[model samples]
Target: MSGIIALLDDVAAIAKVASASVDDVVGQAVKASGKAAGAVIDDAAVTPKYLQGFSAKRELPIVWKIARGSLFNKLVILLPVALLLATFAPFVIPILLMIGGAYLCFEGAEKVWHKINPSDHHSEELVSEKLSAAQLEEKKVKGAVKTDFILSAEIMTIVLNALPQDVSIWMTGASLAVAGIIITIVVYGAVALIVKADDVGLHMAAEGNSGFVQSLGRGIVRGMPTVMLLLVVIGTAAMIWVGGNIIVHALNELGWHLPYDVIHDLAVGAAASVPESLAGAVEWGVTAFLDGIIGLVLGLALIPVVTKLIVPLSSWLFPEKQATPH
Candidate 1:
């Protein structure tokens, strides 16, 4: 009887420890996800665009396809790379982060530039027009997945960096996996809702038993365009801010502290003018705003270089295959 009681106690202790470890992993994962908020927002915002022009019945299917690709990108591809880098080549992580940040900056700035100087160049759209419905759907899914790869890389890296330095390899992996799954579910789930909202609204408007329900449904349908535009704007701003923050922090880590110091000092100064309760918020906002400005400038500078040099070289090196629409 004594031996059996001791064995049961030992098992219970082990179970308690396992439960605690699981909780820790989940806690860390949520915190790391918060650190990668910019990329998360961008993922959510960008995904809906791929569903455009698809039949109502097909929208969810496309989202599912893209979500599957996103999962593969995060778990199968990027997760191993991130863990290896964390294990062996930790120094390279910051450099890769800066590169990813630069890309984000460039993308965000290009959007701003396009908004400021609207261009009629719809080359992709034109190409898409030539493809059959199935082909176009495939192309769009491929494009969205490719974009998600970059963003996922950034998100994973950010999550990895956010973790405590002394965390175990098992803990790190668990945290990252949890974060990736949570983020993927959140982003794609939101995309699914956003894309299907119009259909839902239409159905409700047609079938609702009450006038208020019908009116609300109509409002939802009418409001979707504005919601989409708002999402895009929010995503763009987030990318720039996060990109600039990453670049600045990376520079500081690399021993060039001028930008970091200047931003910190400026934020401190701004915060000093506010009440104590609001000081923290003010400081964060000032820092974010300044970082966004730097990101915007960097992005604008890269635009011409990317357009004039990178795109051309890329096209020369790996030309895209052309396919006619059926």
Candidate 2:
């Protein structure tokens, strides 16, 4: 009858609205993920190191445990905190972003400094020597999860900052949840593959059916070290670039436009010289390059402050307990 037809139309309209909302959530989630690329990459790059000394059998389980902790960090702890901030004290967001950005720059710069002036510190190894296998695994997992909390906080904050200011709380929550799950899966999934690659290669080298397969396996085993090094380098560069970009943008938001203006002009000038087809790419590259330079300089300046003042103060305030070797 006519009543039934009207109800059908109403249901169809509701479905349309629901579908549009879902699409919006997904779109925002993807965009937010892109904004946190530096942290995500660093997470992936750093996680494999925790697996370095563990037997192959324990690697995947440890990765799984860490991944679960990362998820809890983002979803349970950070997501709520981010939402509360956006709701009650939105002004604090940019300050937090700057702090996180500065941290990224400091970490990236420290890596560069260490590379230039390598020093052997076997503190972890020394500690590990004292613990049983199970205890060592527990300790490493705890350390990794603790590190993940910092990175996860940065990722969540970046995602929240990337969202539109007018979005509803529900929309914001959905976007963050989606972004967190996507990033966690991607970072840990990649870590799993990276850690397992060597074992796979070794297995192939030993047990492959044919010479060609065995040779390919051998190549993989030989190539993994170079791949790990490349990943670390890439991660470091990403941290510096993203950190610098965040700082400059934060400064611009806070009404100091000098750095922003200078960088924009430089990018524009660089783009002008390139072919029209390559103009956009050239501009982005130039901007990223400048941002990285700023980050490196800032990071280098912070190193001595962090080492001389911050580290000493922290150690004094919360000195670590020395464990006697069993």
Candidate 3:
């Protein structure tokens, strides 16, 4: 009986330790996830565009497929790669992170450039001529998944960097896993709602039993475009700001601290001019705006390189045949 009580006490201690570890993992995951908010917002914002031309009934299913792919990207691919970096190639994390940051800068800049010079922006037309609905869905899913891979890579790296260095390997993994799941659900769930809002509104407008309900439905339908535009604008700004910040911080890590210091000084100076209540907000806004400008400049520089060199190389490597019209 004494032996049993001793064993029970040991088990209780183990349970307590396990509970603490779980709490730690959850806390770390939430904190790290917050660091990747910009990327996550961009991801959520960007996804709705892919669903734009699809039929109403097909929207949720497509979102589900993309969400599944995103989960797979985060869990099956990025999670392992992040763990490998943490375990073995820890030194390379910063390098990979910078690369991702540069990509974001390029992307954001390209968006700004495209907005300024819309005529210059072009994509290899997805010749979906003969594709049936199922085929089209498959292609879109594949494209979304490909896009998700890039964004997910950025998110995972950012999260990994944000985590404490002293946590156990499993704890780190668990944190990442939790972050991935939570982010996936939040982003896709929001996308799903955004995409379906119009449909819901239309249904309510056309079929609602009350005048107020119908009016609300109309409002939703009309408001969707503005909401989408807002999302895009916010997402682009976030990408540029976050991308530039990442690059600045990465350069600092590499001992190039001038840009970081200058930006900090500028932010401080800007903050000094504002009221105490708004000082922080003003400072952050100024910093973000400057970072976006930096990102835009970098992206504009990369555009010529990407279009003239990268695109040609990619096309040469994977030439596409003409598709027959349906």
Pick the lDDT winner.
1
Give the TM-score of each candidate: 0.89, 0.84, 0.88
Q: Write down the lDDT that model 1 would get.
A: 0.88
User: What are the RMSDs of all candidates, in order?
Assistant: 2.6, 3.3, 2.9
| Candidate 3 lDDT over residue span 1-326, tens digit each | 99999999999999999999889999999999999987898799878877767898899999999999999999999999999988998778777767877787787777788788876654323346447888777887887787778789889988998999988889899999999999999999999999999989999999999999999999999999999788778777776777787788788887889988888899999999989999999888888878777777877788899989987897778666323221
TM-score of 3: 0.88
Q: What's each prediction's clash count?
A: 1, 0, 0
Candidate 1 lands at a TM-score of 0.89
- Encode model 1's per-residue lDDT on 120-151: one tens digit a residue: 34665577777889898988899789878878
Off by over 4 Å in 1: 1-9, 116-120, 320-326
Residue 313 alpha-carbon offset, candidate 1, angstroms: 2.0
What order do candidates take by lDDT, descending? 1, 2, 3
The CA lDDT of each predicted structure is: 0.88, 0.88, 0.85
Ranking by TM-score: 1, 3, 2
Off by over 4 Å in 2: 1-23, 120-143, 209-211, 320-326
Better of 2 and 3 by TM-score: 3
Report the CA-based lDDT of candidate 2 relative to the real structure. 0.88
